[model samples]
Target: MPPRTSLPRRAAKSPALRKIAVVLALVLAYQLWLVVQAQGKVGPGVGAQRDARGRFAVDVELGFAPERFHILRLQKHGRIAGTDGHVVHLRGVAPAGVDALAREYWIRHIEVPRRGS
Candidate 1:
């Protein structure tokens, strides 16, 4: 004889759930569209420059290409580190109080780290 087994039960599907799912999907799609549009071009809200001490201060859009300045990493708390072993900060502009993220940035005279994410 074979041993008996029972499968776990799942909640019954509801029309409300389906509607919610559809709405969420649509909202997500819209957000993705915005991101794609932003990626196509850097907005006026975007910019990057070195300070008097050769440190960096930036207020670039999320999709801003880091390849132009070779920015290695945008650290937490507005600190951005470059490939030159020096840390910089973004001045005059931030993501409107939102935390800044380290994305693709380009610059010159810098060394990129070879390991780790």
Candidate 2:
């Protein structure tokens, strides 16, 4: 019998294992890209303008028309004040809730509501 060899040496010698490893790596990279893309959709100063109760008022712009499911998801973080076209107005959202809402794929952008709008 031969002496024990390292795991990297064995994997390197097998083309099948190398292919599996490459595929797995690519899959991981794609998942990471999705997370980054979601995070980037959040606008600057989102969680900055909070009310006295430490709740935020924001307008979430969606990639598509607002639906019941979308409203429900937003309601998880705050109350849905109204919806206009692709934008949904949310109030009473906490700072941590803003981060969680930003991770939704359908949410294109989340920003503080404009004045006098």
Candidate 3:
């Protein structure tokens, strides 16, 4: 009779290794989502439509209390049309205005109607 040999176990079958793999997967997923957002693949809002004058009425949400600098930055891009609680309405948004405002960390999300919708 020939001698028998055992094969090495797979790393995925280990409990600790499995947990590390799951965490790594989650990190990769989040990075991918950020890339999609940066490329502007994700739509902003449902009714991000332009008005008759070709102006966008955007709603800006600030998750945390905004500082003076954030307010100034937003005002530089567009006029503060109105406000409801933490949400602010912006009018006369420029072509690159949305992108500029979104760069601010204080700004949580910008809602505007998608073009040609």
lDDT string, candidate 2, 1-117, tens digits: 999989999889999998999999999998787779876777888878667898878999998899888899999999998988999999899988887887776788988888854
lDDT of each: 0.39, 0.86, 0.66
- Cα lDDT tens digits, model 3, 1-97, are 9765443355656788889989999999976766455444214452356667655767778776656676677898788876666777778886577
Clashes per candidate, residues 3 or more apart or on different chains: 10, 0, 5
* Estimated TM-score for each candidate: 0.34, 0.71, 0.51
Q: After TM-score superposition, what is the CA distance of residue 102 in candidate 1 from its true location, in Å? A: 16
Model 1 TM-score, 2 decimals: 0.34
> Lowest-scoring 10 consecutive residues by lDDT in candidate 1?
105-114
Off by over 4 Å in 2: 1-30
As for lDDT, the candidate ahead, 1 or 3, is 3
Give the runs in model 1 whose Cα sits over 4 Å from its true position: 1-13, 43-46, 52-91, 95-117
Better of 2 and 3 by lDDT: 2
Q: How close is candidate 3 to the true structure, as a TM-score?
A: 0.51
After superposition, the stretches of candidate 3 with alpha carbons farther than 4 Å from their true spots are 1-48, 113-117
lDDT of 2 at 22: 96
